[model samples]
Target: MKHLDINQIKEIIPHRHPFLLVDFIEDYEPGEYAVGYKCVTYREDFFRGHFPQEPVMPGVLTVEALAQVGAVAILSMEENQGKTAYFGAINNCKFKGKIVPGDKVRLETRIIKRKGPMGVGRAEASVDGKIVVSAELTFMVGQAGKND
Candidate 1:
């Protein structure tokens, strides 16, 4: 089992605080798959405006979190080192449930196909074993530039 802490995850992906969604990667296989977690808290900036009265994690952000998990799987490959994976497209995306603060989202993304610098990942986000979101994400790998 390959476990990755936040720092290790940062080494593989370029996301940062407030945007870096995955809190801990439970395990991963380079170019294969990654399972991670995101501990949602009330202090999150988005909750402030997303719904002060009744906070809810935005669906888009959840998808991004799932994407980040996929990024870890893709970017961890030796050939992809120091590279960035950008979303080429998001297909079959479905929001099945809402994510709330205090929920620990379990994220998983499996690389289903790859060709050259492009690939597709089957992603899912769950809380307490209940699927909240699922999508097929297409990615395009490219050189990581400072502007990325």
Candidate 2:
């Protein structure tokens, strides 16, 4: 088992700022599974417009969080470092409960299968031990090209 702080996570996944949904990875097993967290806060940029009076973390962001966790799980594999994970598809995504500011979301992801450069994963987001969102995420790992 290994743990990934934010800085280490930055080396595996290329997400930043408002787009970087996972705060830190709590635990990980290369090519197997990973757990990460996101702490929702009132100060978030989206909260201001999402709803001023009733701030809630958007469902889409929850999915993004799940993807981030899945990415960490896959990239941690010894064969994948320095590569990039690209969103391939999402399936069976369901939002079960409202996630508001101040909620600490725990994201857990496990790899379901892998073939060549593509992998499939399942992930869930929970709060207080209750599931808030769940989905199957598919992604492709490949060499990262230089940004234009």
Candidate 3:
């Protein structure tokens, strides 16, 4: 298991500011699972237009955050290093609650199946111990420029 800060996460994934959703990785196993966090604030760009009176994080972004956590688990593997994990599909996704500003979201993704460079992860995101989102994410790992 390993704990990763923003810089460390950058080394593993190609995401950058304004897009990198996971702020910190609490702990992660190379190819098994990862637990990460995202601190939502009123300062987020989306809050401005999402609603002036009520700022709710978008459900798609929430799902993306969960996918990033899963990417950490997939890309961290020794054999998969330097590879990018692309979303193959999102299955059974559900938004059970709203995520507002000031909410600290806990994201987790566990690799439940794997075959070569493709796999499925069981993902969930919660705030204050209450689940807000859950889904099964399918991913395909491949070199950045080469299609395979």
Q: Report lDDT (CA) for all predictions.
A: 0.96, 0.89, 0.96
- Give the winner by TM-score: 2 or 3: 3
Q: Candidates ranked by lDDT, best first?
A: 3, 1, 2
Which has the better TM-score: candidate 1, or candidate 2? 1
Which of 1 and 3 is the better model by TM-score? Answer: 3
In angstroms, give how far residue 102 of model 3 lies from its true place: 0.6
TM-score computed on alpha carbons, candidate 2: 0.94
Clashing pairs in 1: none
Off by over 4 Å in 2: 146-148
- RMSD to the hidden true structure, all candidates: 1.5, 2.0, 0.8
Off by over 4 Å in 3: none
What digit string (tens of lDDT, one per residue) describes model 2 on residues 14-107? 8898699999999988888899999888899998888888998989989988988988888878888878888889999999998998899999
Writing each residue's lDDT as its tens digit, candidate 1 over 1-148 gives 9999999999999999989999999999999999999999999999999899999999999999999999999999999999999999999999999999999999999999999999999999999999999999999999877443
lDDT at 71, model 3: 99
TM-scores of all predicted structures: 0.97, 0.94, 0.98
Deviation from truth (RMSD, Å), model 1:
1.5
Model 3, backbone clash pairs (residues 3+ apart or across chains), number? 0
